[model samples]
Target chain A: MFHRSPIQSFARHGMLVLLCVLAVFPLYWMLNSSLKNESEIFTSSIFPHKPVFSNYTYAFTQMPIVRMAFNSFAVSIMMTMLQLATSLLAAYALVRWRFRGKGVIFAILSLTWLIPFQSIMIPNYVLVNDLGLNDTLLGIVLPFSVSTFAILSLYQSFQSFPGVLIEAAQIDGMSDWSILTRLIIPNTRSTIASLGILQFINAWNEYLWPMLIAKSMNHAPLQIGLRLFVNSDTNMWGSLMAATTVSCVPILLIYLILRRQIVDSFVRFGIK
Target chain B: MSQSLDNTIAPSLSGGTIIVRRRLSKKKLRRFKPYLYLLPAVALLSIWMYRPLLYTFYLAFQKWSMVPGTSPVFVGFDNFEHLFHNKSFIDSIGNTIFYTVGLLPFSILIPMILAVVTDRMESKSKNFYRAMFFIPMILAPVSVSAIWRWLFHPSNGLVNYLLVKLHLIKEPIAYFSDPGFAKWIILLITGWKMIGFSTIMFSAALTSINREYYEAASQDGAGSFRQFVHITIPLLSPMIIFMLTMSILFSSQWTFAYIDMLTTGGPYGSSTNIYYEMYRFAFSSLNAGLSSAAALLFFVVFGLIALGLNMVSRKFAFYDN
Candidate 1:
């Protein structure tokens, strides 16, 4: 708590500034490099002497980044909605009911969290291909629709909701649907929001699965498109920077707009 | 809705038996309602997760070329035998360990120090620095690999340019192409992306420590450094150990994208980890059996570690004064 000495404070600020530069430099590089032309990119200059908008136009016209971004959005949005729906139903069932096999079910669900997606990835790929779903957004979205992470997080919060309120609503002959919508979801709004944001971000940033699942740029997300762009044209660093920057906009915008919720979600899930 | 269904169920039933049967069926359905709610998640998990998990185990012992209409032939322990002698598999196992250990300093030690250094700062500036450090963690790995690749470009990149300009090296080396530097580059890229997440986690954990502990430490005539050494470290041990365990478990995984994107485990598998190796065996080589065997081995090993982590976290869950 003490930066009592003026010299100590200066050194501390100095180190912090350097670390900040290291942190922010790559991103700043991406932005500035996108503005540089092909010949200018090879130069060691930090900024372009004559900046151009051609790279951005090239990103849109020369590549399928727009389609890829649309695909990424659709998959992430569907994945988020599906995860939320399944998690809400499952969490409510786990918390509100006195049922048989609850412990076994919970154990089974939590065990899925232990198995990383990579271990099961090969089979999912083969299965998706066999089902003729490869290169379809559905293949990418289906396997991850129900997340134990979401269910478990919601289960914890749902357990905290007043049981007396639930019971009162039930006694008034309200159905479970109305009770969940009226009584539960409204009360635990922030938890649901944090979970939704976490899920959306995860789905948006997914790389390996989509790479394995989708064969073309039509259904593959922006990350995959960027990879394809890089692999195809090795000398197009300027255009590649433009494409990467384009892919980054949605998540960056999400982080900027919902900073607190997104930060909290990362903190909460990163430890787990 | 319930009242209408009830009336429809027994409107013409004057006999007690018919009414009782209708009511009994309704009660049974009510009891079964929880399963209905749970069906979607349970079914999907079983299909995608549990089924594939069992299939991976089964496939581990089988020989399959993934040729159309050809079934997997059970060849007991052959895949495992091949795995034991496979050089890349063995190399990747070692690399995985190296990554887990190499990343420890970047993931835990540095972030802990950063979190501590910034812990007592004014909140506004604290958050700004935190956000700056956290920016990379939010970027896609493909983007990260692209950025780092440009910076480390062999002939005309910033890193080479800077090193040459500073007289570190005369020749611009191909970092990703050279075996010695390939894995290290992967490690650096992975660690660079990872620092933000760890810093944020450490900062979050620091915020949870009751400042009363620090006050109590100071009341005993302890200075700032002494308070950190005595109170802060001890209080933060749970989170520290938790992160340590996580880094060990996930370091190889966190670097997966970078390796796949930049090196492709290239220069004779110099930069490959088990995850990438498994990927290569399945996708490139089309040897599903080999990949499945590798995954089964990891599943067992990591499964045990996860169980231990859970028990350990539960043990340390209580952090109150």
Candidate 2:
């Protein structure tokens, strides 16, 4: 690395620190505002004069927050599991098996990455409506069951796996399914977990599709529920902040726990 | 083909015909197994993704209000003609371009600078800075919008409150309601949400650049800026092109959730992008034909841009073998 003068290094650090504050200040402000009463929230002070727990209490009373959080959690988990399973199977086949139309299939799947969700959303709504899945959790989950990006990333990872190991397993009388599960899957655990976390976070923050399908509170995910809560209770700033905080907690916790893996996955996958 | 034929012929020649038959059948089953593995994902994708895409194109050429028991009617070029003349649609297109151009500073330029700077720092401090920068990228967009909505509040918001205290403004500005401020505010918020992600990507790209190039440049009496320009940038050109293309493509969608939550694309639709406008058409107005047309237009425009970028990237992006 090139050396820098002390003054230049100091200035760089200062700028970076300032940017970091700007990056994190919104979440800080949210947590701070959530703890404040309505009067305190409106004031210009950086810290709450007297932090109160009442906003959270009011938030729980006014909204089906527990239920919504549960809905968000269950939907994200199920979607993650579904995507991982499908992606793993398909990726294994694409990498290990030579089949007719494999190139055509891969090309078609890659094209899905170019087509934005909005392009297909109207027809998808119609499809969901026909299936009578609207206003249900499955409605939100079904459409996202296949992820082209995940499969492609996993396929790339599997391409680097040792073929000798697969041959060794085959000689030991291991079936293809057994080789995939007993060897490939275990070796690529970090990649699988990284993709899973990425999918989970995406599903949790999913708004437009979930909003379209889950019209009622019972099936609404955290993002939609937060929107509805904000719309219906416009003046309850403290409680709204509290509810927003609740919605953000699970994602924030996941990010904190697996920060490196998540970033690595994003970089590897070239996903936004 | 020859290998399989040889297997059958050689087994028959060796007089192990029965055993060969069983093995051949098993080989056939093995050949079919990959298809079985691929079927679920392929089926799901075709029904959910491919079918809807075709249906979108079809619906674009038809007229429908999505009324119950009413079918879509064929209307060739009518939707496109209407969209061309529609004031809001034109404005939304302009706003989409504006968001894309406005995001460049946050998504590409600043992130590049930050990535280069952080790359030279000590390891522990580098990790700390990276984690801090990446925090916003991980936060949910709805919550990010909620916090900013409060921060941009006219009377009681922190931003306005700070401005007044600093004597920057005599009065608080209604950021979301003012047509001039609404689009820019949304842009700024989108940029803030995106910067960390782009920075992380840039950092990853930066680390992959071999240090020997930088050292040799230094020995050649090149300054830091010169080294960065000649060595760092050329090596990082591929990622730079990628980030630029991604920013342009997804900029409209990036601002959608925030626009929905923060302003609802308000103040005379100054902040509305095509994505949100399509949402309004489909859900609010129930104008399925108009929405499909818009979505199709969006796809075609972005698809062409993607194609062009592919060509441009091949020419400009430097790949070290």
Candidate 1 chain B minimal-lDDT segment of 10 residues? B1-10
Fnat of all models, as shown: 0.75, 0.74
Q: List, residue by residue over A159-211, the lDDT tens digit for candidate 1.
A: 88988999999999999888988889998898899889888888888888988
Model 2 global lDDT (CA atoms, 0 to 1): 0.88
Give the per-residue lDDT of model 2 (tens digit) for B175-268: 9999999999999998998888888899999988888887888889998889889998899899989998888888887899999998898889
Question: Number of the top candidate by DockQ?
Answer: 2
Best by TM-score: 2
How many clashing residue pairs appear in each of the predictions shown? 0, 0
**Considering only N, C-alpha and C atoms within 3 Å, which residue pairs clash in candidate 2?**
none
Question: What is the DockQ of the complex in model 2?
Answer: 0.76
DockQ of each: 0.72, 0.76
- TM-score, per-candidate, Cα-based: 0.94, 0.96
Model 1 / residue A248 / CA error / Å: 0.9
